[model samples]
Target: MLQLIEEIVYQVTGKNGLTYDTDFVQDLALNSFDVMNIIGKFEDHFDTTIPTRDVWHLHQVKDVIDYLAGRGFTQP
Candidate 1:
């Protein structure tokens, strides 16, 4: 799951390097639109719906991994 999330972040930000602590806004310099697009990609790839209300909580890469994990996502 972490690897998959990293792939999504790389595809969205065009950055090859990232860490679990990396922040989407502060670290990646992604704007609101970019974040939303990434979130959409996440939903599509994971086949899960992340509510808008919970979007703000996804500040870091780990947050996204945690969120999906809580939703029953597991690493292959």
Candidate 2:
């Protein structure tokens, strides 16, 4: 999942080396639009629409992994 997330993030930012604790805004220096774009990619990839309320809570890479894991996505 992390690998896949990294791929998606790279697609947008043309950047990599993200850690689990990386903050979307602080570490990636992304604005809300970029964040939302990444989220949208995740949703499309998983075929799941994360609730907007829940989406905002996912600020870190680990947070996204946790949220998807809770929905049955595997870590490895």
Candidate 3:
């Protein structure tokens, strides 16, 4: 799941070498538009919808993993 998240982020940011500790905004310098794009990709990839308000709560790669886990997403 982390791998897939990393790929999705990379596909949008074109930045690699991400860790679970990587901060989407602080580390990657992602702006709101970029963030929304990433979240959109995540939704499409996982086939689930994420509330816009909740996207703000996902600050790190680990946060994304946990959110998906809560949704019962267990695959990479």
User: Evaluated with TM-score, which candidate comes out highest?
Assistant: 3
Report the Cα lDDT for residue 32, model 3: 99
lDDT of 2 by residue, 1-76 (tens): 7788899999987879988999988888888788888888888888878787898888899998988989997744
List ranges where model 1 is wrong by over 4 Å.
Answer: none
Q: Which ten contiguous residues of candidate 2 have the minimum total lDDT? A: 67-76
Residue 17's lDDT in candidate 3: 84
Provide the TM-score for each candidate, comma-separated: 0.86, 0.89, 0.94
Tens digits of per-residue lDDT, candidate 1, 30-65, equal 888887888899889777788988988889888887
What stretches of model 2 exceed 4 Å from their correct place?
Answer: none
> What C-alpha lDDT values do all the predictions have?
0.81, 0.85, 0.89
